[model samples]
Target chain A: MSKDAFFALGLLAGLMIAAWGLGRKAFKSKHYDEMQLKIRATGYRIGFFTALALMAVLMLLFELDCLGIVSPAFALLAVLMVSITVFAVYCIRHEAFLSVDGQGKRYIALFALVVLCNGLASALRLIRGEALENGRLTLSFGSPLLMTVAFLVILAALLIKTVKAGKEAAE
Target chain B: MKNLKMKAARAAKDLSQEQLAAMCDVSRQTISAIEKGDYNPSVNLCVAICKALGKTLNDLFWEE
Candidate 1:
């Protein structure tokens, strides 16, 4: 297999595992309380808004690329990144990011693992003496960087929410 | 408006929020939120809570 194709296959497997873990809670909504369902609905609403905004931004950037102003591949990567960002943002927000609960800690730890994976990916590339790319595991829509970006977004939202909640608690 | 009636009923039954939540098959936060007037539960949940408290819906949920 071509390097890109092999990379894509590996990325697909990793993403599938992660997606299963993330979607497990959502798919088992029947087991959740009305309050939990309500929170999940809030996540969908926030995700809708985030996706809409990303679409608008992508449109503008795509036009710029059409004008010979930017590289071509970046536009596709941007689309993938935006999608993961929306999912990450919505899930983190609805979960009350960094909540003082076991589930919250698990999400936080997963976010940390994403960063660690990025480091490992980069380190592997260096060992192979290949040019390092920040977020392009396979290019097109098959980038593992999509997951990393999503995790980073979750981390960012959690930190911000944690600080805000702390202040609210003090008051 | 908050459901102080339901809260009072639960209290009279000597039930903690967690115990009442278990009886209603809900989280304690949901029960607490209901009492705080932050959440309006479904009819089914209301009926369940009513049964658990040994009260009529009119006694706990309805004002009149």
Candidate 2:
């Protein structure tokens, strides 16, 4: 009935969905070595912990009535989230690269875009003195218009690179 | 980079990625990713691939 409870439930649901997808992928491609499987499993665990930590910190801030206080906890959570996301992406990229043809460029380009977006968003938040807000910090630059344009540009470049690489590989 | 060369040589010998993967105890995706220069194989993996392909490590993986 409470908002916090709803948020926690939503987070759990999202995590479950992610876990299901990852499990299916790992099962369908059972040819991975033990080490590779372990690495993949570790990545998933890291992701879950990162998400859990962020939610806990946010909830605590709300409870303490210092959600708006400019503190190190907010920065720490943001950095941890970014790091975990990057690690997860790396694992996914490795898995996809092994399983799919012509995925190299797409993965790299998407990764670059993600890094760029995170870096810029973090910097902007820090500069605008909005990094320590108790509630969610949404970004105007993360608007649909700018995101769409960046996505289109990255997709086009990835497509062109994939085609060219495919041809070269053939030769 | 050198893994790509090894993969090309293995392919020239009429080996599929799955076959090479089996020899190296890795997934076919790993082999494919290595060949495409998207993933770097460990030293152990490189040695396994070279052995499976019937080439010396240097012959398969040496780069200028």
Candidate 3:
């Protein structure tokens, strides 16, 4: 198997494991609402389909010799977008965002931030003509120094927000 | 946290949390959690509980 194929397989396996863990936690939790259960199930389904689609697309691109080693980055971005869309739909359907609880609002905001970051990164890559390599697109940072700084800033913000949200929920 | 307990006000009512859960289309665990004060039901869920118990939200939830 090619390196790209191996990487794709590894990603799929990791996703599957994470989905299983989430499912198990949902099942064990006594306070999970029906809507929450449905959302969790939908997330698992999306993960499965996303993995399948990624592998299929990667294989096709490889066969066509259109796969750039760096091109998988675009596909990864696409998959992340799809996942965020799925989550947003779930939240809307469940009316989770309308609650007075801060936790729900925080979750919605966090997902929105992720979607925005992914969109910005994708646009930047497109403008720079660096989206794909052979046919495989992998994520790339324009400059190592800049990327590190940006990553740290985002990570810190998210962590702080998450901690505050948890405290509010507990109170 | 308050020690919340969903005690049966009267045995003649004979309503189990499981029965209430089924009537409301929620998992039994949700009902259990609510009774134990471990979970807070959403507005829709609170309404469902009131409907199932033939009582108002104030009767079911508020402490006297």
Candidate 4:
């Protein structure tokens, strides 16, 4: 695989670690309640449908971009923005933060760390005339990294929330 | 649709919903929901609440 894909794989590993941490946090929080369970079930249902529709639209857009009717840069940015927005709304509405207790704060800190590292990497690429073209900071790599981290946070929230419900049921 | 019997039994015991829930190892909301008839707990939870309140299952959970 390409270096970018490899780096994304490593980030994916971090995402899974984050999900596990959030699950552990929720399991030990003592804050999971029945209301949260109903809310999470509804949220996941909504998220599944929303994600499915978004992916279908993205697939069509990608096809158009490949055919040169749409720009790849615009499609990537649009997907990244839409994904983050949808996930943020879903997590907020479901109150994942309540179940995971302090996990929201921890996820934010981790995201900040990821952004700082990505910023430095982008700067290094810019200095070497590698990541910038046409006077535009080629966020070619930034798009995936940001989307991945946002997705990681949402996935962790979903994981912890769902697991908390399952744990309560098992108890 | 009130389970006035359970309410009266709980009052006789002078125990709050939270106390009963703790004794039953459940959330206070679960106890409240049971009392309100908003939820029908399982037989196990019914038995647990009956024991916590020092009443029989029929006294707490049976509908006349």
Candidate 5:
């Protein structure tokens, strides 16, 4: 809710919109094949359940007054990011993250860029010791940190899947 | 449960998985999964593969 938080939120939204615009043509459901569509549907189902479970956990923590330093907004945002990351990783591993005609190298480049930018922002916050305020994580630090970690996890999954696919193809 | 018939048909046509997948408008992994019995293709996909390989549905997909 601070000025930094507002700026961070704005940046996050802008980045997401940019990424979505860049990926929409390559990743649209209409561009996916039947198998990819099925796999993605499964991914969505899994992500939905993951979000539900995470929300339940968050509610429980709130009831127990255990969510000490994390703001409700940040906690909710983290849950959303985690759920989206889970869906993306699952789809990527299953070879359904991209359309049949998609240029995966392009998508990988985009993901790498996202990770790099968010990681740098997070590092800046950490170095400046601005990630925390009165021993509590502020939205400014938590948002970028969460984005960096989530995208890093997705990038790792994509890379592993690509390697495995390459090996399989070679065999 | 492996689709040996489909694989044999694909091989008979001298098409690699990637080639066949391209012809069928699916990912190579999808074709690989189908042949390996790791995933089942829908009827439409079966038709597409059959058409691409110049095989009948019975020739490629019908279990003996």
Candidate 6:
């Protein structure tokens, strides 16, 4: 297998292991409380529409021939990441992102790891001059960067919520 | 419209939001939101909270 394929498989395996650690709490509505389920439902709705809007924008950009730098797959992946981030941030703010039995510290640690790993991968690709093809950003650069940004946003949200909850509990 | 009645009832029972939430099998944030009028809980949750606080639906959730 090619290097990229091997790396992708490894990353997929790592993510699967993390998800398994989270178990049924990883987006299973049955693991959430009633209010959390409701909030998650709204978050899903918002994510769906956000994805729809982004796809429309991508389509418009394609029609206008403005999507020259990035490949179609990168563009689609960016949209997906953005929508998922939005949903996650929304649910985090509403105190519904984590399952009822889920620990906030675990998620915070996971997101932090995601941000770090992806950020370092993107940086390494950039340094190796492997992030561009014919002066257009390639998936190697864009994918990891997008994942870093998405997870960074989620980590920030979770941190802020944790701090706020701490203060509230102190009060 | 904060649910002062529920808060008062909880206070009377010497129960904190976290304790009440634990008893109701919900998150403390859920109880806080319900008390702050930020969320109108489902009837089932209302009943659970009422039962946890040792109050009836009318005593805690009924509007004046």
The local distance difference test score of each candidate is 0.67, 0.59, 0.55, 0.62, 0.84, 0.86
Among the numbered candidates, top lDDT falls to: 6
Q: Per lDDT, what order, best first?
A: 6, 5, 1, 4, 2, 3
Question: In candidate 3, what are the lDDT values of residues B4-41, reduced to their tens digit?
Answer: 43445312358765577778877554676677676677
How displaced is residue A28 in candidate 5, in Å? 4.7
Residues B1-64, candidate 6, lDDT per residue (tens digit)?
7999999999999999889988998888888889999889999999998888888999988898
Kindly list the per-residue Cα lDDT of model 5 for residues B1-64, writing each as its tens digit. Answer: 8999988999999999989999988888789889999888989999999999998998888876
Model 4 residue runs over 4 Å out of place are A1-7, A18-46, A60-171, B1-4
**C-alpha lDDT (0 to 100) for residue B33 of candidate 4:** 70
Q: Candidate 6 DockQ category? A: medium
Q: List the residue pairs that clash in candidate 2.
A: A67-A134, A98-B29
The list of candidate 6 runs beyond 4 A from truth reads A1-30, A99-102
lDDT of 3 by residue, A53-97 (tens): 876877787678774454544455555545544544443333322
Ranking under TM-score, best-scoring first? Answer: 5, 6, 1, 4, 2, 3
The recovered share of true contacts, given per candidate in order, is: 0.50, 0.50, 0.30, 0.10, 0.60, 0.60
- RMSD of each candidate? 5.1, 9.3, 11.6, 8.1, 2.5, 2.9
What tens digits encode model 4's per-residue C-alpha lDDT throughout A1-171? 645456556766887998898778666764545544554566667656675776688788666664243334535554555555564556554453333433545554565566567666656665677554444334445554455555556555555655665565466
iRMSD (Å) of candidate 5? 0.9
* Residue A61 lDDT, candidate 4, scale 0-100: 62
Q: Which stretches of candidate 3 lie over 4 Å from their true place?
A: A1-31, A73-77, A94-104, A108-138, A141-171, B1-52, B55-64
DockQ of 1: 0.47
TM per candidate comes to 0.67, 0.41, 0.38, 0.50, 0.89, 0.88
**Evaluation by lDDT, superior candidate among 5 and 6:** 6
Evaluate residue A49 in candidate 1 and report its C-alpha lDDT on the 0 to 100 scale: 70
Two-chain DockQ for model 2: 0.34
Candidate 1 per-residue lDDT, tens place, A49-110, comes to 76677668767866766424323444455555675566556655544323322254566677
